[model samples]
Target chain A: MAKYYQPEFECMALEDMRALQSEKLVKQVKRVYENVKYYRDLMDAKGVTPDDIKSIDDIHKLPFLTKADLRDAYPYGLLGTDLKNCVRIQSTSGTTGRRVVAFYTQADVDMWEDCCARAVTAVGGTNEDVCQVAYGYGLFTGGPGLNGGSHKVGCLTLPMSSGNTERQIQFMRDLHATILCCTPSYAAYIGETLKEMGLTPDDIDLKAGIFGAEPWTEEMRRDIEKSLGIKAYDIYGLTETSGPGVSFECEEQTGMHINEDHFYAEIIDPETGEVLPEGSKGELVFTSLDKEGFPLLRYRTRDICVLSRKKCSCGRTLIKMSKPMGRSDDMLIIRGVNVFPSQIETVLIKEGYSPNYLIEVDRVKNNDTLDVSVELSPEQFSDTVKDLAIKEKALADAIKTMLGINPKVHLVAPKTITRSEGKAVRVIDKRKLHD
Target chain B: MSVKQISVFIENKKGELAAATRYLANHNINLRALSIADTQDFGILRIICDDPKATETVLREGGYISTVTDVLAAEIEDKPGSMAAILEVLAEAHVIVEYTYAFLAPDGHAYMIFRVDDNAVASAALAGAGIKTANQEDLF
Candidate 1:
């Protein structure tokens, strides 16, 4: 049977949910305009004000917030509530420039946890379950978000952060953890470790897994499910909004259902910022309807996906979002062709190689050169160099078919590509360094 | 009739060949005979080592993609056309040689390693021609 943590919000009627979102958005805009000078100035420059935002329909009248705006605001410029009211902060794992830091008030944290709780409940979590949160605990939001949500769901939450795979499995088996939460790569690693330790899915009591914080292919999802003997669910969120639990997959597993009551989602053409109609594939934009500490209006998520309002079998009236195709930031334009590492990954897994691989892009004499270094597993290794060359050419040809651009494929030694414990780093663009 | 040869895949980059050799040297593995086939991007380093199994294990532990294959190793004359005569015999037998390399033994005997399409046919043809071929034990 379908389950929900907050059935009232999860199964709310479309009209009622929109009414609630509009109410929250109006109050949120005014709160940001009055409290945040950065947003207030942006609103003035855009010729928008609190009075202009009468409802969610008027949200387009307000200016959109980008990562650049957050950078300009820095540490405290965008805080909507007083410092005394702010209780916690979570930071992004951004490697370039400045890391984004999001503040949260007590109420804001409660709301975020409630979103996560709904996600856990959707995956069949209950008070009888034990939840293991294996996402990194520190500044990364994955751990804390799921941890709080598991608590809210009354599951015996395992605060075990990421790493120490042996210990993770130890506790998982000893405590009979029913739900696991972490990035998709980590979940795969755990599954790999389980095999290395001669443990099978039957030995563990895990029933479900919540994997996110990075893009993963459907092939990876099936692989994880088979290895761990759990139905893997994808969760979507960003620190810009409130860690994870922005949206989560229900039993339907088609797409994640957005918590429409709290966050209003809009798909916009990334180039023009024009809002596209429902079911359109475009960049995702979110407005934290009632976040008190750092209320952002129309924050571009940079994730490309389509949203559907089709009636779901999960009995949730909330809209569903397809798994992000790729982040606009993660997309690489090489030789005038746009390529995502996830697309390359899908090809790799399909070709019977581990998802561990490296993509190197460089510019030579003004021409972009793409090199893909893939790890050769023992099963694929051959005695004849001619056979190996044929394998490499076949892989390169397959990738060229997928990307519409030829790439030099190098079959490296197995386990040479770095294993990701959190989000995998798959691309190294030498072109950027030269620029 | 045939001996085990370890072939390692190394990228066509500076020090990759040196790195593979250094790994073998570090593991105390000795190369009895070795040959390299190079292309634009990578090279296959084929070696008849003192210990084929140990060399493979060390190379794998060093994160090198390697595989072992059975290749006919026949003792040949040190003079010119020694390889051509062996090749002519194999050609007459219709045993296609994929790749071949030669090295001088410490005892002053020359040996040629021939990777053929069918090792058994090549070995029988070479034996029938009165040419002596080294087995895995004889190579060491």
Candidate 2:
């Protein structure tokens, strides 16, 4: 039937899971309160103390942490352990503001790898599998995290960090890699390259893929599956929460099962910060239950999704978080209307266009303008300007129907858009510069 | 009969068109007839070149979005009503012309290239009307 990395915790009873969370939450709260002055001040300002939280239910009394708090803390302001104890550090891309730096001790690294190993195992990895990690290495956590997890699973780990697509395929075939790990977009690029090389999924030995570090739609999942001839699985994590193994998809693939014993999750109304019940879509908040190095409590993750504890065939009782519909921070307010890049991506994939696109939003003379340049598929390209214009109008109309506002769709030549190896940059808001 | 025409995507940027032409000139390619259809964002530069396949390959290598398409080419009598007569034939055959560009051949004849909705149907109608059509060899 179904499989799990840690069958004990993955199938634990609800009462026992809650009791474990309560014990770890109490210990983690005291660790952050005593060691991290930055969060200690936040707790002090909110009139909260270690004694204030007795059980997991008392979590709301703790001060909430946001990206702003993380920015203020910067390099080491949030370290819950001594400097000598921490052995490693991971960082976010920091495209917005200051980069969030997270530290990990030896034990913390073990725990993080254990979580990731659970991901590999949940996807059916074993000693016989060859795990190739194509995520970027260095300070980025994706490569190292999955590499460590593959090692723990006793699989042949190929630490081939991102880029050099031809080389990636070469090694994948030469070594018969069984499990591929990287961002979903990169996996798609590899698949595209395979076709360019006059090869198909039959040429390689890829059985399953673990993709994360960016948002991907269900349509994309199916596209990658067809291109690679492998079951594509989505893994979820942020650098702030131990990289790519905070939650992972099992064979069932309905949603990702969050490792609640290591991290307790809560959903809250973004506007009021009031906790929502199960199945209510809201901003996700997480608490590090057993992290010793960079312990954070009530950290607000700007992802909008719902939690489901429905019975799954995967035999895991872990709470499932729906594929984040879209990040709250990713929402764009154009002409007084809310838009997400994922919305446009959904329309593009549905219209049989390549997902490679560029969105330009500008404010012209007090009115907002939306322009989307999408790459035309080779099969859809027309020599006549009128025929191409007709295709552009049809795509614009479809997007307008979905978004309630019209977008100026420009049909670009095939393969003109720049592809990405990590997270793809899909939106450019010139209106911000005007503001 | 159909003639090969090369279409290049010219982005609406300063000196982009200049760069494309310079690349073609550097490769010893000559343009026989050219027309540009432009918008606020981008323009499509359609050219009947002496070497259509070579021109497309050179422009593509130079990073220009270029493609070769077949267009119906008719050798008209370099006079006033002769052009109107060809249009009447196309209209009667229900073949719509998306765009047309013309240039005088060195042999003292007027050649008009018509990008029609259906190239095969347009070529058949022009043949049925006893018009002198230019094949790919005639283009060179």
Candidate 3:
């Protein structure tokens, strides 16, 4: 049986959690002030004492730690604790600048595994279920994170990393695996392969899928579920937040319950630094409470979403968050306006095509413009004369609904684009000003 | 003996394919038999073309991701029972097809290009069965 622990500290009435947060938060501030030079200097530079964070509500007064801050701190600068205690470190190859490495102690790993166990359990996974992990392993946090959690849940786990689709299917059928964890793109590929192989959903006993590590659409969810004959669930997290269990979809299927016990969530206006009220969309920020090796305070996760207090069908009393729309970094500034890749995605799916498209932002002269690229299905390829105008209108209407900005839609043939095995590249921003 | 087949990565979107097509069209290049393998994010546009060099030049100039590769094109009898015979030969020869697609040929035979399980063995097996397969010469 998989042992699970719901954070009692989080589910306690809102006031108690806040009280606990304030108390633990104070200790963290003092720990950083006394040991970590960067944070101490930051506080010194601001003329703020650790005692200034008097209440949990005073968190807004603290400076937000951006990815830039992480880069400036770099390597050992961010760690408040000693390197000796770190059991593991996971990171993304920081193509933007400095590689973002996060340290996890043994206790931190245990907690991460517990959270992942909750993710597996939330979707009705049990000891009897076979959890097949296909996310990339090693430096990438996805594979090992879920592997540990599946083991914690006592499920028969396959530590298969991504690729080798044929062998993947063979193992899937051979192990009689029930749960799948991988990127949404890989899931779709696996699903497509199963269909190509003439294997029915009944051919293998797949029950649930926990997909993440890349952004996907509801249409994609539908496609995956239909192909695999299973319920598809989204798991959310980044390497910085301990991989794919920062929040996860419950049986309710509305949104993810932000495990508010181990971590606290805040949504703030990216430009003004003003915290948004509940139900308002803003950049998500985090403050780790229980994390020991390298707990972060006000870590500005560029992911944008709205917080909700609405009670979930699932019994969990944790606060819910709308599925992360997209990252702030991925937000496009076209003609002096901001746009997100997900906005285009929503429109594309609603327009009834597989929401597979790319946004190319370029500066011709001093003005910025966007070129939206899409793939056309074989069904639509029958009539070049009639279908062209209809498909274009549908796509244009979708752009109007989602982006609040019009973009030129270019229709390409299906399979004309490169498929990313990891994170789907959504935008090719070539605006010289931004670069 | 060669026809050049180029694989271009494109998003499944409106105008994207046309842009690639128009670029090639402007260069007076023709797509002989093209197929796209699509997923949600992107698909690879595989093309056998009359002007592979010109097509690659145009595609690159148009800022598209493309690569040219060699693929075998086989002649299949365009009849109901022909496919069965083709598969039986491969089955006996212990050869596999990774992926395959068909195109109509002018002579009334179906030309199928296959990504084979074992390229050398499949080529030998098909030759042993006396099935006429198109090499690079037939492609151009």
Ten-residue stretch with the least lDDT total in model 3 chain A: A378-387
How high is each candidate's interface RMSD, in Å? 1.8, 2.6, 11.3
**Candidate 3 lDDT tens digits, B94-131:** 87665566786555666887665566777777788887
Q: What would the per-residue lDDT of candidate 2 be over residues A33-53, giving only the tens digit for each residue?
A: 889999999989989889989
Chain B TM-score, one value per candidate, order as shown: 0.95, 0.92, 0.83
lDDT of 1 by residue, B1-140 (tens): 78999988877889989988988888888889999998777788999977888888888778788889999889998788878889999999999888888987776778999999998888899899889999777765
| Model 2 interface DockQ | 0.17
TM of each candidate vs. truth: 0.62, 0.61, 0.60
List runs of model 2 lying over 4 Å from the truth. A331-435, B1-140
RMSD of 3: 14.5
| Model 3 docking tier (incorrect/acceptable/medium/high) | incorrect
* lDDT digits (tens) for residues A82-144 of candidate 3: 899888998764232445788898988998888888888888888899999998788777899
Pairwise lDDT winner, candidates 2 and 3? 2
Model 1 Cα shift for residue A336 (angstroms): 27
Ranking by TM-score: 1, 2, 3
